[model samples]
Target: SRILLQDTSAVPTSPWTHFVMMAGSTLRKVKSRSWKKQRHFRLLEDGMTIWYKSRWAGKGHSTFSVTEVEAVREGHQSEVLLSIAEEFPADLCFTLVFHGRQGNLDLVADSPEEAQAWIQGVRKLIHKVQTMDEKERLDQWVWDWFQKADKNKDGKMNFKEVRKLLKMMNVDMNEDHALHLFTMADKSESGSLEIEQFVHFYKILTQRDEVWKVFQDYSGDGEKLMLEELENFLMMGQQEGERSAQLAQELIDSYEPSESGAMSLDGFQKYLCSQEGSIFKPEQRDLHQDMSQPLSHYFISSSHNTYLLEDQLRGQSSLEAYIQALKRGCRCVEVDCWDGSDGEPIVYHGHTLTSKILFKDVISTVKEYAFKASDFPVILSLENHCGVEQQTIMAEHLSQILGDMLLTTVLDGQVPQQLPSPQELKGKILLKAKKIGGLEDCIDETLTDEVSDEEEANGDAESPSAEDPPAESLTENDKVKPRKSKSKLSKELSDLVLYCKSVHFHGFEQARLHGKCYEMSSFSESKAKRLAKEAGTDFVQYNTRQLSRIYPSGLRTDSSNYNPQDMWNVGCQIVALNFQTAGLEMDLSDGLFRQNGGCGYVLKPDFMRDGNTQFSPEKPEERPDYKPLRLSIQVISGQQLPKVNQKEGSIVDPLVRVEIYGVPQDQAKEETSHINNNGFNPVWNETLNFILHTPELTLVRFVVEDYDKASRNDFIGQFTLPFTCIQAGYRHIHLLSKDGTPIPPSSIFVNISISELT
Candidate 1:
């Protein structure tokens, strides 16, 4: 029986405490940089460091931090060949590459299980290190402040010292209020404030004002809100089924233990900032959206090079990539198919040293995990390089695995004049590939007699032509050339292309004239941007009826992604992004799709969907009736700002940037003044304003950055909300990490106001 090796690296597991024996060899330097063997490696310090013994007896051992390690399971040694000698089971061997201050260390494990264990242990330690680093920074910050405020070299601060510290923090407290706080903190009657008391006092001071402001906004009666008003506020924007007066009353009863049947400011604050009171409004999960519109009318969460987890050149491709992308609500996935050994088609990068997985396995995986995240249709963007025989095998695997879930024919027949809505094909998987259809028929008819005679003379045998060569037989040099061959899709495969038949995009005019339902075209990011610039209005008009996909250009070999909003601005539905990457681009993508229940589909704006509306990225002046809105934001201060690194005495010069993302003409941004040398309680009493035209479709993002004069500014935290959902008046903006999870106890206090122009 084959040993099973499940990919669990991406899955979160408890940190490992015990160590397992593992034999690995590391590369050491004999002279300047000559490679020499160093044997007998042991994972030490709970897998936080690796210590390897020198070859010489009684020699000193060198250690490297596991946090800097990069480990990967070895796949096929050769890309062009499929021989057993070059292929090894992933469970048998793996490699580890470590980057450290001394230099780089490359090592290889003797067994796969051992490598897997080491990698898992190292990852756990890395996470633990990061957590510890954060805690240590906070501790240091407390100590630094305590030492500074402890006048006369004392261990604690008296009321005068505490008052001085408050002043330094830009906080103003009346004498009576300060005395009350000092008395409350001096629990032991020592008449001095310790580090713990100081920290607790600061938290209370920051949280009180925020709570009162929120209460005043919701409680129209000024002091408190009635039970009915509190219930309405809690159930705001919730669907009718979810909004229950009883539930709201229960929440009020839990927070407000008063006989007056009213929620006080303190009670409201506790409920609003608690885990139960999420900033994101509750949305109904059922398909309540207008499913009658064509699939082209929705923006899809898509992935470019779905198999790659790193750089395109030598990144490892595995089934886990597919699983991760699918679980993240990616509706469209790419599969580069080529002929594999043993009559099975394989999926991988065509000419790189990347490993391959059986085409059938990919199909089976997709079938199992396709609808796990979303019930909407999945589009398999097939880049076929397989012969007719292997293509048939690929089709058989798909049909057998997916069964009736695979859309094999047009829904309701009648040659759909418009594409079917997502509701019409909920659990279906659509294949987007070139097929022998209308355009192919025209091309076949237009073929010159000389070419037809040559084909007839060869007895119509499917031999290897320059256009369709055996992919495996091509050498590295030959693979460099473009392999743009007409797909010889078999009847079985062509029949599966129900609603995503791939077509080459000619120009704006040609696509508008000849495009039909289920006929989709794709363009590289550069080409799409050029078309948008050159023919913005025509392109927008063309997308109203047909679907178009925009992918990253081949020049983005580093697996970096372009700003998908640029493509989205022109109303392109499927703007593919490199999901493996994490940056501003991916953040925007996540923010956009985070709406609509994160169902991997967002309905296109009404202006873009209307055929009669003449929308152009270039000619925003033409829309005379577009109302403009003035937005004013006051950046006040931040509470418990997170430390970016573990270094002591490190201070953050924080600045708040407000960005408005929408159409080209509607975009606007502004930044508040920076506060120097303060991560904890940095205050910038500056107001930034912007005039936005398309406020309804705009996204307002607040990004906090730590400014540095000698280096690039580092991201502190950020939060993005749709302009429509932003609440005005004094609001406590919760900061979120790069992955959109809220950072607890870290928030920014701000005032927002919006006014519409006549």
Candidate 2:
């Protein structure tokens, strides 16, 4: 009954669809206020494409598929549309945001109803495209090729045209096999194949023999899989446990083409390509980890210099940088505060040519977006180089702008043995800076104190926030500038710093004896790495009670990042990276924080969470929970990979690189040989092996690169997931662009198997 209601139901049609199909409309295309020109736009008869051209003879027309559009904003929500808001009303404006890096197209209508019709009409079309199943998407891709290959615009394609289409689709097919399939699909004997017939030819051409073999092994006959057979297959083949029966029935109902209790070949294929069939486990996509532990018991996502959008030397600082960082689930951000030439304190690199903005503005932006992505606490790591006067101003702005969200004192008015948990301070922002004495010493009087910057343990550092000079602005003589560690502190600013007090680091023995739970220390990457290597278990014990921050080295003037896995291996809570940079380091950081609902605080493994833990990152095999997992991955094929360089005429020669990042013993990389000249759909059936000593903190990265013997290989796309969240089966790993945005229809299919490494 439920299946009948879902299958044979009538969907009500909207009037906007009729309006878009019948009479075309003329709208003003907006680039800027001065470039608003009249253009005639109409929806194609297929309702899957939109065509637009200027109202002049010289202006050529252009058509774009409905699948290209990502979304439609109903009002002036874009920068371009907002720029020309004085001339156009907000209700009359709409923007079409396209997939990938395509620029948005803004348009204005004469009437509100016309704008409403186009907005709703385009939304309906986008919904239809998004709801298409795997088989329908495959058919659409083939039908689009047929339409492009049929130059005469006829409704049919001849054998010669079909043969040409094969080459265009990156298929090096045999001529005899192509002719045989074409003749079989040409059922009307009209010497040509229609759109439906071409789709049939595609189904036969791309049939999965491996999938058929598995299905036949489980099915009673050879065609369909009943509930019992499907459940059995789910348990044995997909690595599902007691829930396999419910999961199998749900998959059949959701993916089966018809209203039947049994699953067919098409339905099974769709289920295998769905999210359940993806490499990452579905449960890990939500908040499934414990959040009631102390703040030091989790690995927090942190940013090194969150205000810079480019090179740290002379990059432009904007509020958008803070917004972007917070939206990407960065729980901790660094702010370098210096006394401005004006009365207000400003934010920028201390001794560089980087641009500055008002400190209040940064606080305001942080206030607006602090909880946008994650509700857990956000730590504002303040590098204060301001005098007592401007420091008071910075304190006022922080308290006023971040009104109720700031953690002014200890959580719950109690100083516990350990710090508060993320759940205890969900919507709060914690300030990490130099304090006068401690949390309870908030006296209402100014004090003269020696306020030197926390010198890095590297022994040659300039300052804590050594946001060094321009990329190449170092003088030959004074490599290490003189330091003045004396300044005045006001009671107003000092009171705001409760928890997360910045302190200097003595040796490990001194820290173990005197370090308070609320006191934290920042270490340079080189120093932290040396400490981890020298005393791995001690560093892990220190992090069990107090938070430690690891930042990039000062020599990185280009704002490049160092791999954070070494720091994280020692159970460091906040390993900061240049969030503005996109590379392998940031990829590992994002991957580690991507689990636990992406709340930006992933709990440490059990062995690393105990203060008396004897587990050493350098020797993870000594831990009790160190059961190694033998991971075997078969790189099967690539499907619809985007070309590395879209402008070049040559197709890409692609190769796949699978990498594992964890303890030193588990870190490894393997690559497949390059396919000569195909980026569209290349298949390489190669298997790679990895043995993970500590699978709890492991991350697997899949990178696709276009191989080039002439120069360095160009990057195509990459996807990374935590090893514990990986699913075992024949799964598709959806690819993401270099900046971590999805490119539609671009994925890699692989078969994964894992067992206990005895």
Candidate 3:
């Protein structure tokens, strides 16, 4: 079954060999300033390993495992910078980077086709190994169950024994179904089944059930679906007019094997598991949300501690973080400015071992990459820690780098009652920091008097008087305290805070009654939650005209993020998240913002923006005019599911979960199903239903997960869409990666139905 090739000389002649073999004399292994004097190399073990001979006698011969290869990409000849002591002429080479390898393995190929063959062959071999691993696990599971069900000392399982086995596997079988399986397995019409017969019976039973369920869901009456019905189901309102029927006919012709105009169960299953079966109509979709709302009226994509690539402390801070965050459509970035040893101010996590980058360099990077991905405004959440002198330099650098793009004055001549819309602030940068009412008010009167008197009486005052205590005589506790300095904002930076001026939140009443133009406030997650609980109505009312930001708590040293939906429910616009971490919370954030062409802004719903409406996240009251809608989702199957990672002997037990998030009454109602060991073509045949009170404000998310017995379930992929956008009927749901990019050829088949409740 398996064959190993030691070198290019001994090639296996078996056509059914487990691995493909390729031998070439031009192949040379290059590593670390020297080419292994090896001219002959052989790709063996299904491309999972490679062997090379240094001499004709194979004296210096070795092999390396290719299963742990990280990347295999094309390499240029110019990349060979070292002097080649050996006289060997190589045409082209490709590099292979392994997980724990010290240096890259560069192999020479005679032609482009040869290099491509190796690359493609290795990728296919890896996939085959993964498939075999999954098969082995499933086979072992079936054998264990068979052994347990044998009960008696016989090597075969009788009808009663088979029934018991079905019950243990959670399949409720009737006499008719039981007899059908027994007759199919017992080829000699015997009353018992041998081991081979049992295995064959188990595979057929699961496959047939899956096929029939899909057929029943599509075709009513449990028979084969007619051509017209198949066309209608696949179209599912995606195609328009008579063209849909024609397209459906074309699909049937391609998938259907028989001349009969009716589609069989096998044909139906094949079509459902293909890329053509996907229900996501990309053409009908459009970013039609209103973009004229005020900047505060939209939920912005924000990042907390944007400089840190890891933990809050002992993390490496770099300008590249800003570049990455901006490229990912983050409109709001945090900058913690502290005094650097050099004259320039630096950005880093204060009171920690985090590295620093020049504030000017950060500003320059932001200026270059700010509008590259999104043209909307960028809000610099400046956490000022530097003194007045360095703060002035920060303002100067921002002014010089940002030039005319910085907001130096109010959009209109007069201060409006509400903040300006994002459309009005397009391509502009806003600074958010503590507002210094006036420069003179920040200085202590005593310190000012001392300075003024010293300058007025130039050199006339004595260094020390007899009444003054001697410096050496005073103890540490008795020493005079140094005057504490107040933080002051320069006029240049203060002027730039035309819209995003940071202010302290006193209380609900004060902020509501006296909040003015450009006076925004921020809250930590804990404090924000507390405020939402105690004064939900007041917080929502205050945010109607002002902007509020919520960030992760200080206790989250791992730079983890809190759930943003809770904050969004309370009308918080800037709910900052740790962009570096990837998890369910980050997935939800990414899914929510995948709309509007990922411009990093989603408009708040009507109820939250309307001041006259009284809405609270803590309380729920029935809307007399608003009717509830029932949503039904049938989890069918998945196709070409991706592996979480490329490691040897890895398998995914995939499951699907449907979730609904909205107001308190319509809050997260989720139902999860069991996992199928077969990740490639898993069929759940489970139906989930939900009653949605606020369909307009609710979001529906479908998450695929991998079940693990000993650890938490790993996320496979997920896709989300607003409730209003979901179309009813048999449709395919295309899954998206955590970063919101479409994973091609990976999708889930589902039938969705929505009905209004009386």
Count clashes in each candidate, considering only residues at least 3 apart in sequence or on different chains.
Answer: 0, 1, 1
Query: Whole-model Cα lDDT per candidate?
Result: 0.66, 0.80, 0.67
Tell me how many residue pairs clash in candidate 2.
1
Residues 1-758 of candidate 3: C-alpha lDDT, one tens digit per residue? 01011111222234323322464445666653554445666674223456667667547767765444544545442133122423333325555644321244667666655655665555554454344432343454566568657767477988888876765553544679778878988997788998889988877775746557656766866667787777666565333346667867776787777888878776775565454554534422445567787776788999888887678878878664676678678999999988888889999888889988788878877887788767889999998777777988998998888899888766666656778888888898988876544222323212221222212221111111122232234454443233244234455555555677676555666666676746777777776777777777777777877898888877787888887877877788888998777666777676677667677888887777876557776664543346679998888777556777444235567888888877667766555565644555677878888988767667788998888888888788888776766756667787877655555446787877788886
Q: What range of 10 consecutive residues in model 3 has the weakest lDDT sum?
A: 1-10
Say which candidate scores most in TM-score: 2
Task: Show the lowest summed lDDT stretch of 10 residues, model 2.
Answer: 1-10
Ranking by TM-score: 2, 1, 3
lDDT of 1: 0.66
Q: Ten consecutive residues with minimal summed lDDT in candidate 1?
A: 455-464
* Candidate 2 Cα misplacement greater than 4 A, ranges: 1-168, 187-194, 338-345, 349-358, 443-482, 645-652, 677-681
Global CA lDDT computed for model 3 = 0.67
Cα TM-score of candidate 3: 0.64
RMSD in Å for all candidates: 10.2, 6.7, 13.4
Q: How does residue 431 of candidate 3 score in lDDT?
A: 85
Candidate rank order under lDDT: 2, 3, 1
